[model samples]
Target: MQIVVFGLNHNTAPVEIRERLFFAESQAPHLLKTLRDRGIRESAVLSTCNRTEVYFCTDNADSSLAAIKEVLEKHFDVDRRILEGYTYTFRDESSYKHLFLVASGLDSMVVGEPQILGQVKDAYRMAVHSNTTGYLLNKLFHKTFNVAKRVRSETRIGYNPVSISSMAIELSKRIFGELHNRKVLVIGAGEMSETALKHLKKEGLSNIFIINRTFGNAKKLAEDIAGIPYPFESMSDLLGQVDMVLASTGAEKPLIEAGLVLQIMKRRKNRPLFIVDIAMPRDVDPSVNNIENVYLYDIDDLKDLSQKHLSDRLKESELALGIIDGEVAAFSSWLRQSEKNPLIAYVIDKAEAIRVKEFRKASQKLKNADEETIRNIEALTKAIVNKLVHPHVTLIKQDSDREISETIKRLFTPDEEDEKDLDNRNEGQ
Candidate 1:
């Protein structure tokens, strides 16, 4: 069977289009079941904010991709032509390599973000729970986890915080050293303020003061994220009390001018205050940065830092890509040999059967063996079986001669019933 992935990502589709086709966790099982009904048994769906992808092992890639598109069309009510316009398809090695990149966080919108790896794990778990993944998908996902782990341990791709929300937290940490018990004034209840506040919350800040144009919005946001809500008129009062201020509003002009902060800083005897203005029209005045003991960073400043961090991750990503390439080649080779060589399977099955039988007999003789002792025996037998079978399997894989294949086949030939059982197992896989 060929491994194929068909889907659209943030790179290929915009938010509006991607949202139209996004699948929720509850919907993934139904999607997998539908694919199974359509004759695509081994399948998984990974739907995230940035992308929605369906991975499957199918004998016919073309027909399988069509089946996925059809399902999307019927279930999500998106036109097939729209999918064809925005979607991408990769088969075999490319398909898995794409998965490796995605799982490793190299394919994320904010490169090196760690959330996608957890998302990938969640998707894989959902597929497994749905009974959709078989031998190939199970092996593929397990290997994918290993690859992601290796990339994380080997490279510093995800070492830095790159997103605006994360960068805001980073800046806060730099100023305050430890944000524990430190007060933060979030000067908006909009989406940007909410995102930055959520990031700040993770740092164990003592209190977050949220203010919005509408008092109700501030209260709602505060309740959702466990922050204190304040009226818009209380901005100046909250500014003097808090250690940091994060302003992201849709106002037409600068909300916090130099004069306002200058007065606030003077009231606290010029104590250090960090202000992050992420608004478009600039919530904090540019002259505010010139004020003594008042550190202000506009959206452009944060974007510059984000770009630098992204560049660093991109450099580290080269190393991660190298790791992925090696793994992809090795996994592809293993898949090829496993699919092409039934002799390998037969030998493994035969060896395992012998090992189990011998272990059972030995266990019977040692009637008083404890759990630990039985486990040790099991490990010992497995090691011995692997050691004994390794050389033969290696030789069979390396040799392309018919005589070598025939000799190995004859030596490990199972009985009629055993042969039929092995055939059935392979067929099912």
Candidate 2:
């Protein structure tokens, strides 16, 4: 089966297109099962805020892609025309290389961001739990993870400020002078909010508040970050109190609207509010960005900041890619060797069977000969058979050269009816 990856990402498609094709975390298992039911033998879905990818092992590439696209259309309630514009497909070696780059963070909008590796691992685990993963995907992902680890350990790819959270904080600092005195409100207790908070706290920002749908989770995160826990009911009321807001909630609809922000701005007396919305569906209304004294940023807004670190990260990425190239070549060689093993075993087994059958026939006609002569004939036949097959066996064992390996495979692969054909030909003659 061929390894294939088909998807769209931040680099290839805009947020609007990505949002249309996104697969929610809860829907992954069902999606994978549906793909498998449609004759996609092995599949995994890696859906994140930046990208949605389906990696699968299938001999029928066209059919597999059609199946995946059908499922995506059904899930998102989008037409095929919409998906056709943004989707990309890769197969075999290209797919392997793409996944390696992805896991190594080389393909992210922000190069060297470390979160994609964890996200990929989580996707792999979900595939495993759903029983959709098989040998090929398992090997590919495990190798991808190893390459990612090597990249992080051997280079400074992740040393630069490449995350959306870091970029948002940097932009805030540029606009507000210092985050130390700025009142920051983090909506939702998700990983993105936590990351933003971590960056803000490191900048000596002490005034922080966390609000979630569940007060218990909000309180727990608040306690961890030493921030105040605001009730979910007071989200609108609290919007006016903070100078900066980072929203990454799991709400389907926007938590903050343009009118809400306009009211909040009136309360703050026209003071500027830097809002960063990092959620997939987007926690803040897009139209709110047009308001005066309201600088709203989404996942796409951080692209310029992410690009600023590209040159430095590119140098580190070169080192990481070199390592991945070597690893991939080594893995390819191992896979080639594995494929040859069964063929070699079949050749040896058939050769031995032929030798045994010939010896038994010869022994039937040796009754008149002495026991010692019979033993001598047997030894001679066995010796001749061993000598005849020695060169072929040696070539199979020493497949270091491509030509010799190919020659051995071509010479020893007996046809299914070769023995019977030989017997029939001999009898006819």
Which candidate leads in lDDT?
Answer: 1
lDDT of 1 by residue, 1-429 (tens): 789999899999999999998989999999999989998978999999999999998877888888888988999998878899999999999999999999999999888889999999999989876778766787899899999999999999988878888888888778789999999888878888877777788889999999999899999999999999988998899899999998888999888888887899888788789999988988888998898878888899989988999999999999999999999999999998788976786687677667767887899999998989988999899899889988989998898798987777667765677657655656856
Query: lDDT (0-100) at residue 39 of candidate 2?
Result: 85
> How far does residue 310 in candidate 2 sit from its true spot (Å)?
3.6
Tell me the TM-score of model 2: 0.53
lDDT of 1: 0.88
Report lDDT (Cα) of residue 255, candidate 2.
85
lDDT of each: 0.88, 0.81
Candidate 2 global Cα RMSD: 17.1
Provide the lowest-lDDT 10-residue window in model 2.
420-429
TM-score per prediction, in order, is 0.77, 0.53
Candidate 1 runs further than 4 Å off: 213-217, 250-263, 266-271, 290-293, 342-429
Q: For model 1, which pairs clash?
A: none
